[model samples]
Target: MNADELYPKRVRSQKSDARRNLSFASRRRNPNLRMCQLLHLQHLDASESKINGSSICNIRSVTSLNLCGCTNITDMRLIGICTLPQLTRLSISWCVNIKGHIIGCGMSNLTYLELRGCDGLRDVNLNDISALLHLEHLDLGNCNNITGASICNISTLTSLNLTGSGCITDKGLSGGLSTLRQLQKKKQVTGSCLHSMPSLRRLNVSRCWRVHDENLRQMSTLTKLRYLDLSGCAVTGSTLGSISTLTHLDLSRCWDVTDVGISALSTLPELQHLTLCNCQKILGATLCRLPALRVLNVSGCSQITDVMLRAICALPQLEHVDLSDCATIMT
Candidate 1:
């Protein structure tokens, strides 16, 4: 309920030994119990409850609210929910009817927000969200009427998901880099953590068909990224090599990936979990080179034969692997 679906795919791909996240855990580790005083720990779960619009505003003192899969949710009810003074984390995923730009209505305290699968949210103003100074984690996956250029203007965000958003094209990404850096420079001297936070630590642009290497390779300002998903994108891996700090990467169904590009991945010291499923080009020749990889998925890679499977199984640090649908690999 606490914006848990913000990293939906990441949670599903995890293994028993998935690397621990110390990013937000440090605050929870503090010995002084009072130091970690959270805003509002109370939560309301009206998700799919068929709750009416008038009754929606009656809820109070709630900080985290879950309205996932709520088919009857209307714009007015959503507006009422957003007006909750203490609301900080909200998930309106799959809410079919939410429209209008009124999400910014009295919602000045939001830090985590998820609007996944809400295609009705289109033509919304960037200022309505940029006004949310504390917003850090945001998911706009599968939403309509979004432009990559507009997203780059929100300088305070740390994690962003634009999965299946056709608005993300190569031209837009190339232009957004300049817009991002310009915003970065304008807020460089700000002392507030809300304004001074660096570029995205996690990003998901899966199923964005128009994202190619011609635009992706030029964006060097995104070097701070740790988790990246380019699943079903048409990148050839030129930019993947430059993101050396990346620990988790998903390149599933990236058809253009080849030995040259995959070989470049061996140099990534911190990378652990990688998924290259359905990639027709992967032959497993260069995959075993990633000796430090812990979890690997090469499922549906038709070119991976039994010899390649042996090579993959020999990886020193590999703990888990998926060979499903790889008929060529008889072993």
Candidate 2:
């Protein structure tokens, strides 16, 4: 017999044992049990396992729950998790089949939530989140279907992550975040994030192919943005110049951007991490001007010459550099 036969997998967690049957043999001696402060329920190994509806209901006291990579489970199971009032943090990444339609759940106490890789999630039901007055941190990355309309309800949120969610135009940023400005002062709300949800210190909007420089201008109101990622976007140099306060920026795969556009990007004195991968137009001269840059990724920029390599070396603060796949860089 293997360990599987010796110790059968229990449906209810060990924590439920406290609320379960209290028999004479099991209860005669007091078993010293420790309470779990946080619970993460992921399906990394059991991606195809179907979550039993009844078993899911048994987990009530869990404050933090993760259901990432659980491909087999539907939105119904996720809805079940959100109904719990005590939940503070939740992650449901990579559950591709689940639709983004959230409605009628009491997510009032949630402070941190992650909804990455739920590609099918389309409509975010704002009515469900209006009561979540205490919510702070949220991540909606990689949900390409959700438009800016869904964000209209959660303007009270502070730290938001919108790394790869789709179809967020200038109107969306202006509509969603601007409404938030009414709730608090500039210091409380404005940071790197666009519109009014400004307390964001770090933001990632990479691969959002539709966003433009005008959208970045809306973000200039956010002076507190320390980390930003604009990789694979269509923003031009004019748009990049609008966000001069960024400390970390990733412009990899931004095909439309040229060396002229990046000229203003190097002006940020606090910039530490800069990535220009696949931005085919950038030369070595623009790379050398970044004085505070520590980590720079220039892979796939074919226009860089040997002279630019020396320029890159000239930066006093430069530390890490990626010259991979650039055929013309000097040896």
Candidate 3:
């Protein structure tokens, strides 16, 4: 009897995927398959089943695993995945039932881990997770229960995404900054505040209602920052000014940000991807000044007109542009 069938269809599909994965793992008859060698596995809409953890143990060669939208999962199933000594990348976004630690001691080698939308997750021991020194990317989006204490330990992290993590505040981020010394050189630690992650390359704190630019400005110390998302944040023009090396900027849903803030982006000569979705105050003229711009999304910006579209087209590197929902544009 397939216990998975008795549950929702999502559960059934998760079990089916696990079965297929187990079958594939069983086929790898070559014992010479190097565990340290890189491997990539992407499974969309994965569900949780009792069989998944055991199947993960069989795929010793897998290094990167992306299981996006695996809502049917809880914590125990992912424990099996942690045992893989070479595993690095793992994305379990929208996996609602994953309430606690799935991989503790075994995740020492993990470089990238995304737990976005794991709403039920409330507790995570910072000490256990801080062991992963190789970590570069981590996403904790929409986990309202997580507090600042757990985040404080991950100072070695380079790329972090906390979009919609409502519970986080400057206090938690500040704690994280304080602990960064052991992970990087002393010069990398510039700001006395939370944003002082010196080696950081990508930072997404969008919709973190509690965070303000005062603490966020400390991120200017990270001279290598390439991507920054301040949408729905209290960030103003000065915040953008600090990050002059940014190549991608997303300021969507930022009602407080006006043309003055948009102008600050012009200082970023490397900027290529820009999203100004629903920010009505920025004028069409402001869009034309961006040099080296390629992908621009101005959806829901009613203030923009055909002139704004023409300005975007004038950019020699512009390859993709989206003006959807812009009421002022007729064609």
Candidate 4:
């Protein structure tokens, strides 16, 4: 009589049951049609699925949605997504069809948003996103159109990824990041100091060629930073001297950094993961000075021979070491 009562018998049948087979095929073709019945669904990962914007609107209770690599998604579909009142985390990475003016709607509960490689997204308005007071983690990596002003208002953000977003310049950091340092000082005076001085913990600006020494000087004020990636930027060893709070640092492809710059890292007592891939100038003298160093990536550092390897092996805490492409290292 009912669809549920008939499904069990249909599945057990060996005969060519046309009605039962058609029903199963229909459900497979339109998975969203069945998902609409699941009112309590909290997480939906319809990534790379044929599900369109209209189908997504049916799942109203979802809090986390990952539509990454869904090239078919458009700006109109994003409008439907805003209506989901419980949504807090959304990842639309590589969704190139999602263009301008798509974020300013009713996503007040959103805390984490990822728009990496969203090529169509241009002229994004920060005013729309500023309403999300709870927003913390944002990844605009490879979104070339993003400027500094677009993120200046989001002072509540803790983790930001801007890798390959070269349009962002020193002016952008001055406007947005400067406020974070001020907030940290205010929190310290109020005796609400948590783990570090600033709320920001992780930041990646790799391949952002416009970022230079002055920007690093400004970033040094974020005393709470534990993870920082400045690979492929225009900074020298002098910049490393400014930030002593960093634990995980990635300076891969930083050709300008020499042995003198490596010495500055000695001040970071809590340093652990250090990536110096392609830093050919470092001869490995300062490598042993890091007392807490655990993971070290010195791949492509041809200057590092057995002498450097000996110093690296002497570190009692060292666990993982990347000596790939080192011509002088014996075995």
Candidate 5:
């Protein structure tokens, strides 16, 4: 007789007992039961799981955890997660309930943290996360409460996304980013207390209305940048010469950028992705110099006719092109 049919109740109890008795070694030998426990788990994606605090407390040995969209999660649950020693990456994006001084709870080992769309987060001090020496990637996009002071102490950060974080003004950028850049460059100087994070590669400050030419000029010190998104910022052509290392540039909706600003981008030989959507000033024919361009978006550029298309087609690597809302492009 089958084990289930022979002794249904007793068999189920025995199986549970057997599972409980199974050691880490035995679990490793049985690959099928890998998900039975957290001992060997290195990554956990509980996004949108509606999981509770007790469930999260049971998880250990996981290096990466994605709790994105876990709307039910609160700061009380995060206290339990802080006990996880090996957690290196944590994504709590859109978890609105997680607000106010949550990172100070033993999250020093985290290298990547995403708090995007966490609108409830306000007036958080960056000094709280300053102890995280290995932190490289931090996304605070749409977290309007986060100011420039929130990033001053994180000198190890390489990628930072502050899209739509209106609270960050020129003072904050200068205090944090400009100071960090200076600290990184002056490593040989004596009595330099600041740690070097010269590895900064990507920065997105899009929709920061307070960002003007002065702010962009200050950002030019970040020479290692590969991807930069300054869309909707108040910058002019003069800001382009400083960031010649950029490969992916997004200037969409920047009404201030005219042919002069577009002409300045020709110096960026590494540029691959270019977005100029809603830029009403571009009259066309200046993009042919960029040979590495693969993606181009000129949507809402009313003056762009077949002349711009001809310049874009010359790019041998061009793979994606968006000309939507262009009145001159024939159907």
Candidate 6:
């Protein structure tokens, strides 16, 4: 928000991330910051700048803070952040320096936290995050040393993103893919799974290649999932039909996904937007069962011919279809 707009009690987020980082040069408070103390600022975006806790501790009413790309800030300043009782959303994406517990005590009101590129996310802090009883959304893409085990207890989460978390495996999310394996790999078990957070609506495990169909099946109690992105994972959509609430699904580049697995998706009556880009194995015959589908992306399906296109044509509700690079389709 601009200087003139900061006086309101119920402040909205700034229109852009371009806001100047409220810098307190050499711990000397900026005279320009005098205006910030007087206003009841609700949202602050000081990303990629020199803003520190010493300068920001006074902004008590701030409910949302975007510190994404702020390379200078460290976990030490989180004590200053914890002072803001109303702070809920904090984005520290790409802040590589924070190598310790980012969350301090007394910041329980937080509902959304994004640490997309921080490497300091260890089991020590990931376990602490479960204390946030009100937390609903968390993004830990490209982080390290964290598993579903560390976060399995946080039953309050509604949206979670583990994209590119290669350390995560089938045994982490599921007790074990098979009963035989369950005993062999029982030590890796996190007790509950996709079931641990039953309230989850949107989950992104894209590129978590260790995740598999057996990991997603039988043990996956994700009945509330509406948006699930398993793109580039090892999943074959074996038990995906059980997630009947799904509407938007992305299985792009999932080379193992086949027409047999795609057949199970036919049972998802609510599915509308489905993406299977580069998944060449499917011939597109089973997609006819998804009559409610509105958007379909089968780009790079080298095996798809005119016959497959004709099968997709039967989807009367299709609004946006992507069949690019299907060289086999003849006029």
Best by TM-score: 4
Clashing pairs for model 4 are none
Q: How do all the candidates rank in terms of lDDT, highest first?
A: 4, 6, 5, 1, 3, 2
Residue 7 in model 4: lDDT: 25
Weakest 10 consecutive residues of candidate 2 by summed lDDT: 181-190
TM-score of 4: 0.75
- State in Å the error of residue 84, model 2: 4.3
Ranking of models by TM-score: 4, 6, 5, 1, 2, 3
What is the Cα-based lDDT of residue 253 in candidate 4? 90
lDDT of each: 0.63, 0.60, 0.62, 0.69, 0.66, 0.68
Candidate scoring better on TM-score of 2 and 5: 5
Candidate 4 lDDT over residue span 1-331, tens digit each:
1112222212224333422122333456555656556566565666665656676677777777777777888888889998899888888888888884768588889988887787666545656777788887677767877764567677677666665665654445445443242221100011112223255666665665555665576656677778877787666756676678888999989888888888888888889999999988888888888879999999999989897799788998899999999888996
Candidate 2 off by > 4 Å:
1-48, 68-85, 92-104, 115-124, 139-146, 159-173, 176-193
TM-score of each: 0.69, 0.68, 0.64, 0.75, 0.70, 0.75
Which parts of model 5 have CA positions greater than 4 angstroms off? 1-38, 69-72, 99-102, 117-125, 176-199, 236-238, 289-295, 307-321
Q: Candidate 3, which ten residues in sequence have the lowest lDDT sum?
A: 181-190
- Which 10 residues in a row give candidate 6 its minimum summed lDDT? 177-186
Worst 10 contiguous positions by lDDT, candidate 4: 183-192
- By the lDDT metric, which is better: model 1 or model 6? 6
Q: Which stretches of candidate 4 lie over 4 Å from their true place?
A: 1-33, 69-72, 119-124, 177-198, 211-215
Please provide, for model 5 over 173-290, each residue's C-alpha lDDT reduced to its tens digit, 9 standing for 90 to 100.
4444432321111111111111133344665556655556655655465677787777776765556757778898888988898877777788888889999999998876777767
Top candidate (lDDT): 4
Q: Model 3 clash pairs?
A: none
The residue-by-residue lDDT of candidate 6 on 153-196, one tens digit each, is: 55566556665554654445543211111011112222235444
Per-residue accuracy of model 2 over 160-194 as CA lDDT, tens digit each: 55555545443444455532321211111222235
